[model samples]
Target: MRALAAAALAGVLVAALPATAALAADPKPDIAVTSAADKANYAEGETFTITVTVKNKSSVDAKRVHYTGGDSEGVDDVVYGELSTGFDLAAGATKTVQLTGKTNHVAWQRGYGYVAFELAADNGEANDADNITSVRLMVAGAFDDLGGYVFQGESYDAGWTPQTPGVEGVKVVATSADGKTKYAEATTDARGLFRLAQLPAGEVLLTFTAPAGWKILAGENGEYDHTPALVIADDSDEPQIYVPAKKVPVSSPSASPSASPSASSVAPSASPSAGPGLPVTGDNTMLFAVAGAVAVAAGIALALVARRRRVHLQA
Candidate 1:
């Protein structure tokens, strides 16, 4: 009887175990950051728009899914600051939330910057791996602006250091470090200064199609033409790029000096013939000399004949 009673209790406990487990395993929302992106082309001293996509991986809907943004301080692993933004995410669905953040000066020591995003739900998350994400950040000084002049000639050895005179009306393009994505464009003003604000810091490439007859000065790398340049934009780094321009046709001066003078001299070909007074050229002077000689000889011959006739009559 005792063994049967114990077995019955054990069966009851086994049945109750599932109920306890079910109670413990509550229905929770699993939210995670699937992707994090910089919504705007960020620059130093400019505000950045960070977009975080949160996915509800659980079967239950995630209510009041909130997002926060942070950045690692220059060469440091610590992240600070939380942007205030939130949204509701349906089960098996994704919601994107945007927040604005001001970036600090770029960390040149690390050679790059970074931004982090965290996604959470009202209840709780089942997995943490997907809830946090980070990406490469590009920034300049938190309050600084980037601009410079484009002129003709080779860029001085350390030209990008200061704000030099700019070339007006030049179209400049700023692209992603990979050179595939275009961020923004600006036309230099009358002062030759063109500014794209809130630009991110990283290996950014610039594309400038110099004027038809102009060429951008070669950079420190010794290559002219704004094709691909890895520019580091930070407070410690040089925010301005001074480009010295050289004329496109390098041989122009040499080619022009002799051509104009030579052409003008040849154009006066008919001027000598059309002159108001006759020009005494070598050919014209020879003709005049021959005629004078013939006249003098005729006079001498006539005088000789007169002398010979007088002598004959006397004889």
Candidate 2:
């Protein structure tokens, strides 16, 4: 009976050992700022991303873990209230949460601020009240008061005409280096000038297009080579772009031998002609010859009349 009782006690102890150890472990939720310290700096009123990583350090599973910013005493109000969703975490598992915040004041004066965080396990285990983790964020720059960055390039050749004129429009599009989104856009003026002001500092692509006519020589990629890329710096000035003009062949007038001769070639041949088949009436020599013949005929007729009168008198 004693041996049986000892065996029973040992079994009970083995089962309870894991439970006791888990309960004895400190219940403070593990929280850390996942964003790199160098990259987390922000300017006042500038929206930036903050990533917080939370882990269940205790052996007990945590259901529907709820978290909130602890205190804002030394922190900027602009850096708070940005978490999107709340989730549960399994024991020993980790969850990452993203929050967005804007700085209300310049962090340069204060150097850096703290963002305290509190966590509670949904499994009815209370967190260690004294062990909450607070992250420090520095403000490196001021919020940009300017609008989007403006980009301007040399105007295209005047001889270059668009394929579609009045109805079609020309636009300049600026895209992020990652190609995930378009940061800004501007329409070209009558002279094909575009401006994209106050863009974020990074590598970017600038692309322009109109209906037809105008062809882009550079800054294009892919099968048709229709896209152009450009880089923008943090302190960059207005960007200038120069696109080469596409040469269009002009059509010349067609010469046909079958067509009528030109006026200059036909004018000389149309003047009055004195050659072979033309009548002789306009010549001075012909007029003199005809007058002589008429005089001879008149003389012969006078002689005949005189002879006939003499014969009649004799009779």
Candidate 3:
């Protein structure tokens, strides 16, 4: 009887061991902000993107990760604005999020030496030491614009011309003088115009991305090259220029000659500037020729009349 009771107690303890271990297990999640970088800086009201990466280092997964980015003098405090990633991160997984933030002031003040970016998880994290990062950037620059109409280099009827405002939504990119490091971009508007504001004072190239069935004409730089580099004086708007898009002539089948072709010669083509086959006016040669012929005929008629009168009188 004693041996049976001891065996029963041992079985009960073995079953409870797993339950006790599980209850004591800590499901803690550790999330840390690994790195943050400022891709570029922009003026107040200008938009820019920041890259933030976070890792879930704990044994449990993290959910609803949130990120807040701001600028401050110390770069440690999140003073500007915060945003949520609104996603789940698996344990041992790292995620890179691009957070876009705008400046509250027009220009970046010199007092703010650093930018702060932080990441957090909805599930409480065990360690919060690594959740923030900071970096410095140059946010000083002026705004300028280059815009113009894009049109077909062709003339139409009625001596009237039109612009290719049809090219709305076309992309125009502004880049450094070396044609690298894109500064900004804007889509052509209904007026076929695009502007790149907050530009640094220096020579920069403007490149137009051709839409379907369109191309820019050759220039001093090169055919279809990023347009000639332009100098933007401090806070000065670059002068607008006209851009021509190549037009492909449409082809149509020529009608067969009439069943019975006429013997008459085909008329001459119109003058270069004139619309149709209209004769040019005031031909001095023609006028003189006709006048001489009329004078000769009159002389002959007068001689005949005088001779007849003389013959009648003599007879």
Best by TM-score: 1
Which of the numbered candidates is closest to the native, going by highest lDDT? 1
Q: Cα deviation in Å at residue 23, candidate 3?
A: 6.1
Candidate 3 residue pairs in clash (backbone atoms < 3 Å) = 142-199, 143-198
lDDT, residue 309, candidate 1: 100
Residues 215-279 of candidate 2 have per-residue lDDT tens digits of 44444322231344433233334434544434334455698569787775443333456454434
Model 1 C-alpha lDDT per residue in residues 249-270, reported as the tens digit of each score = 6434544444345553333355
TM-score, structure 1 vs. true: 0.36
Error of 1 at 139 (Å): 2.6
Cα-based lDDT for every prediction: 0.61, 0.52, 0.60
Q: Stretches of candidate 1 above 4 Å error?
A: 1-12, 20-28, 34-41, 67-71, 74-88, 107-112, 140-315
Off by over 4 Å in 3: 1-24, 38-45, 68-85, 104-107, 111-117, 141-315
The whole-model C-alpha lDDT of candidate 1 against the native structure comes to: 0.61
Candidate 1 residue 124 Cα shift, in angstroms, is 3.2
